[model samples]
Target: MNTIKTIAARAFLISAGAIFYINPAWALLPIQHWTEPSGAQVYLVESPVIPMVDVQIDFDAGSRRDPAGQSGLASAVANMASKGVMAAGGDAALHENALGEAWADLGASFEANADRDALHYTLRSLTDPALLDKAARLAARQIGEPSWPADVWPRDRARWAASLKEADTRPGTVAAHAFAAAVYGSHPYGARTTEETLQRIGVADMQAFHQRHIAACRAKVSIVGAVTRAQAQTLVATLLARLPASADCATPLPPVGEISALTAPAEQDIPFASAQAHVLIGQPGFARRDPDFIALLVGNHILGGGGFVSRLTNEVREKRGLSYSVYSYFAAGLHAGAFTVGLQTRPDQAREAVQVSRDVIARFVAEGPTEAELRAAKDNLIGGFALRIDSNKKLLGNVANIAWNDLPLTYLDDWTKKVEALTVADVRAAMARKLQPGRMVTVVVGGQR
Candidate 1:
């Protein structure tokens, strides 16, 4: 009987192509949302097609919230969360080893990531009742009671410091660091890890940060897969209840101020030994909830985000062969983000490449996308939308973002319609309003000084 069940599962998966592909025009699966009694926001999508579950929990505790002079504190703490935690007052290393064995036995995958605005913890496990329970318990402990093992701190901190030092040597890294610093002077967004800052980090610091920032009030939990509403409610409650109900000790992160309008274009060049020059351009862009976001999204596809079909690629790469690739995007955050165009070119052609890229952008901003380009972008976006949410894991990521950004529940449902309604005029007008070529910052690494 067991062998028959296993064969049936494999056959079903093979026939169904692993995931049920939804038509781009269909409404996205409904998200069941509620707040746990512990104050964590919960979003769920019941998917019974596969006997698996994915859970992602996010906290507003990213590097942006790190204290002054503590550049890498948040990242270090996030990394250490999985190393070892005090569970049941036993040896931390032994506890972590056992937990690892348990996950291996249950075929669970776990990960933690920290970015500028949030820290994310994710778990994927089979929905077998016993297996699910163990995975959830392990995740809860990692979230609520990080042990911050004394012995593990030195090794983790050293590894992080070494990685940062290595990254600083790369020209692309140099350009990115210089660009972010120039764009966000004195803001926490400009924070970068250094040997000095890493030295200041310690296990105690991580413990304190965890206490203050990893509270239920700051959490947004997203769950997807084979689970009932009652099961989801119980699971989330069990997980989040381990965390503090409120941020009693956290110093609130200040809102990022608007970028001041540039009177003239800002330029920076860092000499490096390389055959190709790495270049970056543009200025501050809209927040996540900016009304012009959809228009800008559609327009950027024409400008550069649409791969070989983009204007930047057509002019810079295909037309003149100045570079192999060039692209632009808006890195929207909780606060004002950046719009950037980036590329690499032969050292001697760096100046010309920047000029051509800027010219392409200026033209696009002045006239917007052509009717054909607008239509192509919308069609491509709408057509590819289904792949974005075709799997349980992918859908969980989208649901998490929606919950974190406080977007309307209908955001996913309305995505295609929004893109479809955008006109050439809308794209042109939005680009002209949001992007200013004259005020942009330019950074080049690895060309003549």
Candidate 2:
């Protein structure tokens, strides 16, 4: 499946809730990190349990780098990558269908996507020497020699525009779009992909974005599988060989500013005909790099992140029956992301539901959680830590996170301890520092009268 349809599906299809704990012997091995000769930062975990390899290469070319008029440029570029690779040396060019068949023949696969903070390309293949070599070379070409077939863009653009129009009809999509716009203001994080924006993007824009933001030096490669340090280095060198060589991290690219903080509370009420009103309440949360990240984690659990056991669920769902489901979470990333509380109830009860959620958040942030609540939060978080890295893909993701955020190499092993070390006072202090109930933005789409 060389097409964007199949590649995008594989990129986003993540499994949830492992039935067994992640094996400490393999998953918990200390990470080995170093800078490669090509200037890409590499993090490796040698787990020989399976004769397979999973590699994720991340670049700082996510949606945040998209041009102003082309909000979906990064995503479009990543999708076009799978269309095929240009020919070079003595080899003939391969079409999308032929390229997909090449990977299938070798029992290997690759996928690419753009998240809020980075563009991710993942390759998976058996550790067999011949197969691995073919997979790596093919992946390198896709990363470096994307053709951006002109014939493909017109058809794909129309498909994308139609898809967005269909998705826009849902209230949930409308609510999320409004909430993001209100919370992120001028930041690129708030940018939305509309039919107009998609129409403005062409194959030329995709090629330009790829050229400007993608380079060998900007790659952060994370590998988890049966590979030694020397082997990994050689593999990385081969993978990035075709890309443009440029200055490393020492030479900064265009700087994306930190998301601006909100000044006063803003509320938007929209009119719609629906049985249930979609509600979103929140403000900018801390960045993943924030020193108080550990404290914020534990506090959010006690506040509303925990499912049935959270304060939001207890007050808004069980206590008042205002909504059947309510949850809160922090989307911390390179910059401060949104800390949102979302729920849906009858259109008439939307106001009460929003008010109840707001009150719960204000009280939790102001007073912090109690001693008992803190213990429970810690217990739940620490108890299920193993489930987070149950598979090779999950382990690769965590390694990638640590690498991208410049987190300590021991971040995974220290996660439970950090959660366990937090005291009630620490949580309270961190919450007080990170959240401002008075300045939050409230967004209700198809809900508020």
Candidate 3:
């Protein structure tokens, strides 16, 4: 019976060609749309096999909304929401009891990422109808009405401050923070939370941020899992009805202009540490909606983007043995995000490592991938595409990304075809247009250069 099922599934796939990575028979369905009474945009997807459901509600309440002096308010608001709610009892017991009743994992965890235009609050859970009810109630109440539990503020703030101080002591952290500031300049994207920022994060600030940003007006809900259409509708409705009306909810996402070259020199003397130092060089790259995404994606694979076979890894690690690992990648965002090249090596070899990495990037940008590299990159990318979309978890993540970026629904279906369609000229054009080594922000931490 199992063998028959396997053969049938494979046969179905073969006949269905390439409509979907799984269940080719399952037609490409539009993202079911419905507006909640409260006006939150709801997106529902049905996959009724695992007898479970995953629910997500996001708000434009990202850290970008943090006021000038209060850089951590959005994070604090998100954190406090789940810790307590207006459930069976007050917030503390509400959280404790919810955990006792069923599994509750923090999708956003305790981390805070604030961009200039938006903030995000996300949660996921298994589908037990009863648990679903409780979760919706809890999530809605938290987003709609949150009161910071006493004493939690000072404790969490202390921990946050301590972590920031500790992160300052590490080379990698130093490089990342410095890179953001260097690349963004006076933009809010470059804002960093210091001890002063943390100290100024009052409970009133969190309340104010939550009221303004976590309102129903900015909500976008997505659910994809083992949920029936009826169940999906109910789930979305439950979430939507709990949010506020969409008024004045539009958050601004402005473009980041070209950033100046930046260099930050810092030293952390760690006793009894390895004599090696770490280096990171980067600059702002393309936005999520850039037309050259496919070209850059394929081209980067041949450059320092891919692991063992990347140009940077080959030149720095394999050829010169300057480091054990080196690589580069472009992080696409709402705005031009980051194009970062990273590596670790001995202090004495730091300068050589930085030079080689920069040279590789420059060459790739000037000439793009050779024909052979481009072909391999396309073939590898297209062939591996299925493996990337083969699971529910991966598909869910893809859908979230699509909705987040407002990508067309047909993106996944035509992605491989688009990648394979690129010519070497396309790659060269993309590389030249995207990567600028001289304008890059470079940071070398540890060991004397």
Q: lDDT values of the candidates? A: 0.82, 0.86, 0.66
**TM-score for each of the candidates:** 0.92, 0.93, 0.83
| Candidate 2 error regions (>4 Å) | 1-22, 246-251
**Residue-by-residue lDDT tens digits, candidate 2, 138-234:** 9999999888899988888889989999988888888899989999987999999988999899888888788777888889999998789998998
Q: C-alpha displacement of 375 in model 3, angstroms?
A: 2.0
Name the candidate, 1 or 3, with the larger lDDT value. 1
lDDT of candidate 2 at residue 77, scale 0 to 100: 89
As a TM-score, model 1 comes out at: 0.92
Superposed model 1: Cα runs more than 4 Å off: 1-27, 89-95, 245-263
lDDT per residue for candidate 1 within 149-222, as digits (tens), equals 78878887788789889998899999999998877777677788898898998888988988877887677999
- Please report the candidate that would top lDDT against the real structure: 2
lDDT ranking, best first: 2, 1, 3
